[model samples]
Target: MYFSGLVSFLIKYNHLLLLLLSLEFMALSLYYGLFLFLSMMDYEFFFSMLFLVLSVSEGVLGLGILVMMVRSHGNDYLMSFSFLW
Candidate 1:
């Protein structure tokens, strides 16, 4: 529910900052779900650590995207994005 709310907010806002924040929230929610499932299964903490590393990697990637978006558009908006051939 919380993550879905974040998704809705991102869709309505549709800007780079919101996109990055939403991605973090999404990753956190996934980590929570994974932790719960692994705990129930008696899995090791190593899986949670792996997820934490993944979340950090996701933050880096999302920030990279935001930087590129700023460089290309000089502002945050969906319309400013374009594809290259």
Candidate 2:
């Protein structure tokens, strides 16, 4: 199925949320991959968990910045950045 114009627009403009979601997808995929590899090779899972935690923390921080900016400016457009200074 293809996304409609509104979905595409959201993905284009809501970059921070999009990035966070992408990171979450990556982290989940990596965990699954690591689990499969470990089942085959017999290694510990701590490293994969660590990476997942780091990605989550990064997403949290990124979303926090996005929320703060939106709260301050009342807009999510890139043009709002000019008001930063």
Q: Which candidate is the best by lDDT?
A: 1
Q: Model 1, range 16-79, lDDT digits (tens) per residue?
A: 6776776677778888888889999998889789889988998998788878878977977766
Q: Model 1 misses residue 41 by how many Å? A: 3.1
* TM-score, one value per model: 0.72, 0.64
What TM-score would candidate 1 get against the native?
0.72
RMSD of 1: 2.8
Candidate 2, which segments miss by more than 4 Å at Cα? 1-14, 83-85
* Number of the top TM-score candidate: 1
Cα distance off (Å), candidate 1, residue 17: 2.1
CA lDDT, candidate 2, residue 42: 85
